[model samples]
Target: DAGVTQSPTHLIKTRGQQVTLRCSPKSGHDTVSWYQQALGQGPQFIFQYYEEEERQRGNFPDRFSGHQFPNYSSELNVNALLLGDSALYLCASSLFGTLAGGQETQYFGPGTRLLVL
Candidate 1:
């Protein structure tokens, strides 16, 4: 019955470095999505994974990638990171079927704070 959980509550990296964030979905949830929230900006969708496959992606560049495991946990990896990548990375979980009707509510993790210098 636990809600979504993310690792590394905070991180610090230099430009061009790489970082990986992790997440564990809530019980009964089968889909995982990643989002990036820059300071003062709303969260931007990065990608979503289901059935251990990427189901959808957002406007993010190829540097942003993710993977879903059989247990429904997920990981978000950012490569060649830039200063702009500094933000709060959030992980969300929800039932895929509920999304079809546009009524699904995603439960979000506390988020990992990334600071790129």
Candidate 2:
């Protein structure tokens, strides 16, 4: 029962550059969501993918995008990064289905810490 996992515990990028982080969902789960957590702030949803399509997304810009593969794994790509993009990128997993607002229990990974220059 491997839980959700993310890569490059830490990453460094410069303004205008791009980066891609990966994630593998927990066992028996099919939905993957990406989040951004700044210092001392709660996680902000970026988007969610189920059945290989984006199902929901927050207020993030087009610079932030993602993909989910047949293996239930995911990747988050951020292009033209900015200093504000320096934050922890978190990947969470939930059961395959519609989650009720404020009721879904999301299992989060340790996160990929990104630092932008």
Candidate 3:
């Protein structure tokens, strides 16, 4: 029953470069969501994937994209990255349609820290 896992625990890149972050969901979880958390800010939703398709997205620009595989693993990609894009990219997993009575819990990964110079 491993929880969500992310790759490249830390990364450094320059503006305009591209970066890809990976995540593996917990057992029996079908949905994967990505979030960005700045140094002192709470996590902000980037997007969510279910059944290998993107189901929801946040206010992020088109530079941010993602994909989910059949095995419930996911990837987050950011193109033409900006300095402001530096943050901790987090991955969360949960079962879709299990939010009974508005109670749903998501298990999160340690996150990949990206630094843009």
Candidate 4:
């Protein structure tokens, strides 16, 4: 009955560096989504994973990608990072195709804040 969770709550990197953030989906959830939230903006969708494959992606560049594991856990990998990549990276979990009132329900994990210095 574990909840959605992330690791290494905070991170620091420099330009051109590569970083990988981890996420463990909530118990019984099979889909995982990654979002990036800036200082004062709503979260921007990064990508989503289901069935151990990337099923959907946002408008981010090729540098951003992720993977879903058989255990339903996930990872967000950002390569060639820039200062603009600094943000609170959030991980949200849902039941993939199960919708309530025409909307999918998601459980979000406390984000891993990334700072590109």
Candidate 5:
């Protein structure tokens, strides 16, 4: 069974350019969440999608958005990216209908590292 996977392990771009990262959730999972992890900080939740609808979103601006497909795969898109956007974009999967101990213990994938110049 496949767990989770991401593409383009590393990327470099200039400010104002857009970037798209991909993710495939573990088998038998139905929910996907996107997170941004800065250099010395914990991962911050961006948004979560369940049943193809956005269930919860964090304080991130509109520039951070994502989508989930019927196959439980997801894609995170950032528009007009800024230099501050440079960070590790992590994709996590979990079961939506039920919460894990009141907190989701997300299974993560090797994030796509983003660097902005």
Candidate 6:
């Protein structure tokens, strides 16, 4: 089956602009997680959604927001973007497939490359 997928494999935006990135989880997975990875750093969790509700979030600013649709697809929106927002945005899928929901493993997508000028 296809793993997680993200739109606009690459994007470029100016500072203060707003951008929205989309993600579709793997089939059978109902949870989605967004992460941001700087050029030289590991991926940092931005937020997570399950059942169309935001179940968890990381230490990201309000400018970084997201939503999960009933279909388990997700979108990450960044407003008033700054150069610091440039990074590789990754989406991971997990759980809601087999067994009861408890511990789960996440499979990450290739990620969308975003650049803020």
Candidate 6 minimal-lDDT segment of 10 residues? 95-104
Residue range 1-117, candidate 1, lDDT tens digits: 788999999999999999999999999999899999999999999999989998889999999988899999999999999999999999999888754633267999999999999
Residues 1-117 of candidate 3: C-alpha lDDT, one tens digit per residue: 688899999999999999999999989988999999999999999999999998889999999999999898999999999999999999999888756512147889999999999
Q: Which 10-residue window of candidate 4 scores lowest in summed lDDT?
A: 95-104
lDDT of 5 by residue, 24-112 (tens): 99888888998999999999999988888888899999988889998989999998989999999999998875554223567999999
In model 3, the runs with Cα more than 4 Å from the true position are: 98-103
* 36 Cα displacement, candidate 3 (Å): 0.3
Q: Each model's C-alpha lDDT?
A: 0.92, 0.92, 0.92, 0.91, 0.88, 0.92
Off by over 4 Å in 5: 100-104
Q: Which stretches of candidate 1 lie over 4 Å from their true place?
A: 98-103
lDDT of 5 at 46: 94
The Cα RMSD in angstroms, rounded to one decimal, for candidate 1 relative to the true structure is 1.5
- Cα lDDT tens digits for candidate 4, 1-117: 888999979999999999999999999888899999999999999988989988888899999988888999999999999999999999999887745422278889999999999
TM-score, candidate 5, is: 0.93
Q: Model 4 Cα displacement at 57 (Å)?
A: 0.7
Instruction: Count clashing residue pairs in model 1.
Output: 0
Those runs of model 2 whose alpha carbons end farther than 4 Å from true positions after fitting are: 102-104
Lowest summed lDDT across 10 adjacent residues in model 2 is found at 96-105
Candidate 4 — number of clashing residue pairs? 0
Q: Which of 2 and 3 is the better model by lDDT?
A: 3
RMSD of each: 1.5, 1.5, 1.8, 1.8, 1.6, 2.4
Clashing pairs in 5: none
Report model 4's TM-score to 2 decimal places: 0.94
